[model samples]
Target: MGPKTYSWPVATFDPLILKQPRWILAIVVGVVITLAFVRLGFWQLDRLDERRVANTTSEARMSEPGRPREGVLGEHGQEVNEMLHRATSVEGAFRTADEFFSPGRVVSDRQGTLVATPLDLADGTVLIVVRGIVPPGTPGPPAAGFEPPSGSVALVGRIDDGEKPIPIGEHVPEDGHLASLSRVDLAYIDRWIEGDVLPITLILEEQTPPDPGGVPLRIPREELTEGSHLGYAIQWFSFAIIVAVGVAVLVYRAGTRAGPTEAFPDGASRL
Candidate 1:
């Protein structure tokens, strides 16, 4: 009845279980993962190159003088993306009462409204003219006695392709009064103006001074930056490399290990 000693069984690890077959499988998986990562990295690099080319082309086009041309109004559909920031001259009388104001356009630390007016060409077809940006909170025509150009005047502006109309709530009118128009819908404007309108819209580059309000027409500078696709691609590739390396290390260790040894009791000695 000295001390009641209890002995517990010890567990042994079998290194042979991780044999050549298992090591081979691990190497194969590791190589596959590494290849996948390398492919992803190259794909990211390709996309970066494409973006660089596009940015360079756009900047070069913007720096040159815009093209100015005159043609028959409202003849057929025309693609406007090619003429963006390019100069175009139009001779038509500005429709005063029909001027539409687009609010909430914030650019270059200045908030203002984009003014859109229908230009009645000599041939009776209408051209939508964007008369440039005016300062926010400016009193519109009726409120400040604003008066548009009288007779047919020369106009020059950048061509902007129309986009889909912004969705409105139920409280907003669908057809009647013009409120804060978020997007430019050329088809809707054509129907509203009741004529064959030009597919391209002009952003007015020059205009007369505002009537009573202190609003001045201006253009905001746009700042561009490189996107994060390259960074994401690098991360994905790095992950794949890590996975491959981890598997390789495991396989290498397994290949170099020795067989397992039996365990003995605490008091036992090697004989």
Candidate 2:
């Protein structure tokens, strides 16, 4: 038999290969990518607005005067409006004998216990007052007994809501007398007092005697982080835009590399 011959055509770039399908895909991809970037930019703008509003609300509350002492303790709505650093005054006597200790509190890089005492207000309502911090290694109940300010003392303090309880099996003291559990369970306080207790709590700021028991009252400091959300929002949107653009560029390149010759492999040549 005669030698079999095979001829393979040399590949050549055809500018006409840029057809309707390629143009369509390019337009669709470009539009989609552009839309994605625009959406992300708007999302960041929205987050910036939200953060601004939050900051304004917080500032307004902080700048406003403290709630009136007469109806403040029993009022639930007032607690939500209270901001850190806002001061409140109360006329009350501390329940020294019935004092409780909150363990595992850290202040100024030193581990300490927060002293909580039920303040019996002049009107017979009980409000939980976090008097001050006691140094670590001090026994749960000081041997000399906890001493609050002397008779009918007036106190100015910052408002605080209750805290969540520590997990079960945590190393909270079980002894009911010397120390109670880790959490300030308000319900338990109410039951113990046998009266309607205020939902709000206080961190003592100023007292009649500046130095009560030689321990100066510690006021809480507020830490604020500004523009954090706007930064995060920008990051998320930037990532989305990068992803969309990358996909579009890859699709456009692939389409451009494919020529019209492949559109029909077996059809006869048309000049």
Candidate 3:
């Protein structure tokens, strides 16, 4: 019979083994990546905080009683951001000739176009109003069935800021009397409008003597819910943990695979 063979177990988990230069580099890289992921997680947390504050402010502003448009604007116009979502009342006559369409607005998963019109206030200034959403494919101005009521009108609406303008090439037609605009940018619209244009847009909530046809659907108030920032933060933190675990696993495998520095028979004696 062959003599029984026995060997000592290698020290696979020795902390000293990880002191090698290669392992040190791996650890440094892993730590850097982990810290980056942690930073991303914290960044998401910060975004969550900002969102909460904004939501709170909006809710508070929206719940208050409506104020006169002039009062909201003050002697010198207030920053649009500070007044956003505040309810206000205005009286003006619709300048239907200068109307434009803002396409690609989606409501409740249904696509539609927003009818943007210039309202000539009594003071001779123009206020941009997003009246409501219309069916897709509706024509721009002087459109049949979608015409806003003629003559002076009173409006109750929430204050809103304009959107970023679509680049020249991207706007539909890109020519005289634009049929549709990519967004509700008042600064861009001011170029074509005849009078001074208000910096903010009014998202129309109520119109006196409602449109007889009711063709354009009234846009609902925006729903305020905490977004997915928390989930993203968790995901980033989980990635950091996973990277740490992966680095630990790789280090353990490297140490184990390196084998022992010395091996001895079971009965052998060491000096």
TM-scores for every predicted model: 0.63, 0.66, 0.86
Q: Which stretches of candidate 1 lie over 4 Å from their true place?
A: 1-47, 71-77, 139-147, 167-175, 208-215, 221-226, 246-271
**Sort by lDDT, best first: what order?**
3, 1, 2
Worst 10 residues of 3 by lDDT: 169-178
Q: What tens digits encode model 1's per-residue C-alpha lDDT throughout 131-190?
A: 656667756631133445567677766666666776672234476654445666777776
Which of 2 and 3 is the better model by lDDT?
Answer: 3
- After superposing candidate 3, which stretches have Cα over 4 Å from the reference? 1-16, 167-175, 257-271
Model 1: per-residue Cα lDDT at residue 22: 65
Q: After aligning candidate 1 to the native by TM-score, how far in Å is the CA of 234 from where it should be?
A: 3.3
- Quantify how close model 3 is to the true structure by its C-alpha RMSD in Å: 4.5
Candidate 3, pairs of clashing residues: none
Q: Candidate 1, which ten residues in sequence have the lowest lDDT sum?
A: 68-77
The runs of at least 3 residues in candidate 2 whose Cα sits more than 4 Å from the true structure, single-residue gaps closed, are 1-51, 64-68, 71-79, 82-85, 142-146, 166-194, 210-212, 258-271
lDDT (10s digit) by residue, model 3, range 120-220: 99999999988888888876565558888889889999998888876673353546575577878777788778899988989888898676555577678
- How many clashes (backbone atoms < 3 Å, residues ≥3 apart in a chain or on different chains) does model 3 have? 0
lDDT on C-alpha atoms for all candidate structures: 0.64, 0.63, 0.84
